[model samples]
Target: MSTTTLLRSRPSRPLKGGGVSRTSPLKPRRSRLLTGMMLLYLVYTLVPLLWLLLSATKTQDDLLSSPGLWFGKTFALFSNIQDTLTYDDGIFLRWLGNTLLYVVVGAGGATLLATAAGYGLAKYKFAGRRAVFAVLLGAVAVPGTALAVPTFLMFSNLGLTNTVWAIIIPSLVSPFGLYLMWVYASDAIPHDLLEAARIDGAGEIRIFFTVALRLLVPGVVTVLLFAVVATWNNYFLPLIMLSKPNLYPLTVGLTQWSNQATGVGARPIYNLVITGSLLTIVPLVIAFLFLQRFWQSGLSAGSVKQ
Candidate 1:
């Protein structure tokens, strides 16, 4: 064919909406708006934390004189920590230990019980399952504070008041955790997988341990972290249960120290309070950072089939 004929025979490309073929640059207004919203939220969440961090590094005088979100004239973070640890015959260290103990036992046990119960409720079909779930859902709606007075009275009658058990025992029943695990397990652990494991001669317990447990890691971590935080920050329960300062967790202990500021003998250690608050949150931040990858993996596990 001739070159002119061949050129004429080629079809012309259609224009989008029969308009100009010129490409428009991608509009970034939505992206910018989303970024702005994220930044606003970050600032809202971080401002208080920043204030705490900065205040921890200042002496009482400096804290009063200095700007709220900037460094003070003198950096006294190490000294503040030392003073916090050494204050009142080193009671802060004891409080720290007690807090750790409560978190380990209470949160760990809560996680285990929640995981088992949730998995059972999701996978098993037994008598009173719906009733149990209904009661659990109702329990979840009940604020813990509402139960504190009754719990105190009951524990007092049982001669368990002013003991570690008062704190640990109550924390072990996490209705929210149970509910979370139930929802997560229902989606994460496929029915077919469970059937396959059973076909291969696996017992229910063994299948749960080896198969469901692996898949439920993210939800488990979430519940465990929440339980840990709740137990760590628990004040009312420990305060109402235990009369002794020796048994106080960090939350109660810190508050006690803060109250000394206005007590008749008024020994204001605001620096230590601020410093201790900063230190208290550090472990939680570390836990999140460490478990973040696993948590992310667990959340996304069943999104795509293998």
Candidate 2:
């Protein structure tokens, strides 16, 4: 009879106020507003990329006259790509190669050095650690553009200006990346494991490489993405540091060709520029999609024994 009665009774009343909180009244409105804003933001962000994609499909004349949001011709994409490739003795390919090299050399080094330094700052205790961190924080505040002149002069003194090292070396030190690592290491890496590793006779470098680094991968990936993007898009530094046309990265190369497109009666190479720009983004997009796997945090779940 008790079992029958329990089966027949309504489920015990959910604890009154179990779900909604005091702030519940405002939630629907806030959610609606946030949804509206996000929709607007999506349109704003995607609109330009859409424009670029559509524009890349048009000829130079069609691009200027056509409504950018819609397609005028569906099949010009292949022809545009062909022209972009063959344009001006294949300088486009050279520029693409240069950009890739710069990104890999500069951003790659920065990611590694930042990871090591960040891990050390986050996990280790030594004299002047706080002071060193404070200095790094200050370095972040100093704009990269602001230091370009000083950097150029220093590089000039060393005969590094106008060379790949001029850009690559500067990119090796990212204060922002260091700070990110420090923050991530503080919150993400568990200290109990560090003690355990010490108990097992793991040397500092071994523990960091074999344990801490694998755990802090998301933070490392985040910094690497930023560094790669920064190095790829960098224009001002390369402008000041490198003058040789052969040494120009894509940003400078594109700007040079783009400017020449405006030469009197040359008929603007807008189509080529637009098309090339789209192609330039392909490697980065592909890289993000591929390297994202490496960025997963908590991947080292079993590295430190329970």
Candidate 3:
């Protein structure tokens, strides 16, 4: 046989130990372990939510009488929702509206500021950049709750207490969100793109709004969601800052309702509290679900290089 024919007849073999094998014995084990861990996490996360779901369907007596995780004899979800909305002259609805307002202004502002600041920090060679980052890192390490008292005092001195500004101002500054945007912008946005935009006679502001902002959408949405959740769930700051029930966010307002279940002249409206809590989470859940696609797309896009 010719040498060429002989070589051709020989089966092609992969280079020794160089390429990844299609089937590895360890892979199945790793996959199973990962799947098990994920399932465990899902169960852990869902259990409380499940309990909340079931508990919301029950009346106060049924909630006390029934098994904690199971449904009651009668489902009163709609009735409970009605009571929750109408209670105290629809103050719960007002709290919900106030929470939305805070989220819109505070979280929206935070996202805008964080995105601009992060993009600038990533793209620009500014003076005091290192010091700014150093302060930001330090601030990130500090617990927000620890600063609540001091912030309340400062706001009080400024005569901003009992006003929406007290909550909105504090919520606007998100060190972590800024850091996230910085990292995402550094990776997601190409410097060449910015230069190209400039070459086209675009101003810095124009480049940001037109070019960089489009790429930063995913990160911006992520930061916005975080800010929304933070502002929406903010309890301590509002508790300290606002003296009037009219100014309370849902978190504080709901807690006030829950507290009514205890002490003298207690309302015993535990059902309403549970239902309100359930209602309070719906908008956040919807926001997450709606924005999930953008978040995932942004993350995936950021992971790839130009």
Candidate 4:
């Protein structure tokens, strides 16, 4: 036998315990504890939504009498929806319109502003950039509720209170969205690509619209969804700012309906309120489902290094 053939045929040494242990590739190991916890969490999250769905189908009397997680004898979902829409001269529809306005203008505008500002901050080298970032971080740390009183006072003085501007204006400033976009833009858009675009004689605005915006689809969708949810669910700002029911968003209007059930006059529109709440969430659910792919991509943006 040749020395080379002897070397090649040498036996491998065994690991500790006299053999190497290997897991089956097809059957990955999983922790039962973690699986149990996740199952519990799924139940926790889904139970309330189930209850809401079941409760919405009941009449006022049935709603009061029925088990929260089960359907009542009478399925009055359509009836409740009709009542919710038509009650008080279809004020619910007005509130729905107001919410759409706020979401379209306020959320849409916020996403635009945040994307521009964040992209600028990430790409441009300017004086006080660090200071601006510091301020943004501070703003994100400060909860909106903390600023509500001051915002109300400011809007009151400007005669903007009780107007759509009160809600729309404040909803436009999303510090978290700005921060998210800044981080996303920094990683998602290559600096070299922008330079190449500039070299190609494209103006900054044109570059942003053509190059940056396309690359930022995921981030933009994420920020837009966040802004929509925030503005749609905004309760305190609208509650404090607007006195007129006409200007009320779904959040405030639904709350007002809920409150009406408890006051001395006590108009128990529980069925309408429940159905309205269900209707209110449907759009958000659809938006999330539709944009889910982009949103997931956006969230996973910075997880891996290029």
Please report the TM-score between candidate 3 and the true structure.
Answer: 0.87
Screening candidate 4 with a backbone cut-off below 3 angstroms (N, C-alpha, C), the clashing residue pairs are none
Q: By how many angstroms RMSD does model 1 differ from the true structure?
A: 10.5
Provide the lDDT at 92 for model 3: 93
**TM-score quality measure for candidate 4:** 0.87
lDDT of 1 by residue, 204-291 (tens): 9999999999988888998888898888888899999999999999999989889989958999889999998888889978987877
Q: Residue 230 of candidate 4: its Cα lDDT? A: 91
> How many collisions per candidate?
0, 0, 0, 0
Candidate 1, residue 72: how far the Cα is off, in Å: 2.6
Select the stronger candidate by TM-score from 1 and 3. 3
Candidate 1, run of 10 with poorest lDDT = 6-15
Which structure is stronger by TM-score: 2 or 4? 4
- Candidate 1 Cα outliers beyond 4 Å, as residue runs: 1-30
lDDT of 1: 0.87
lDDT of 3 by residue, 15-100 (tens): 33545454654222256878989999999999999999999999998998999999998999999999999999999999999999
Q: Enumerate residue pairs that collide in model 3.
A: none
lDDT (tens digit, per residue) of candidate 2 on 69-94: 88764448889999988887888888
TM-score of each: 0.86, 0.81, 0.87, 0.87
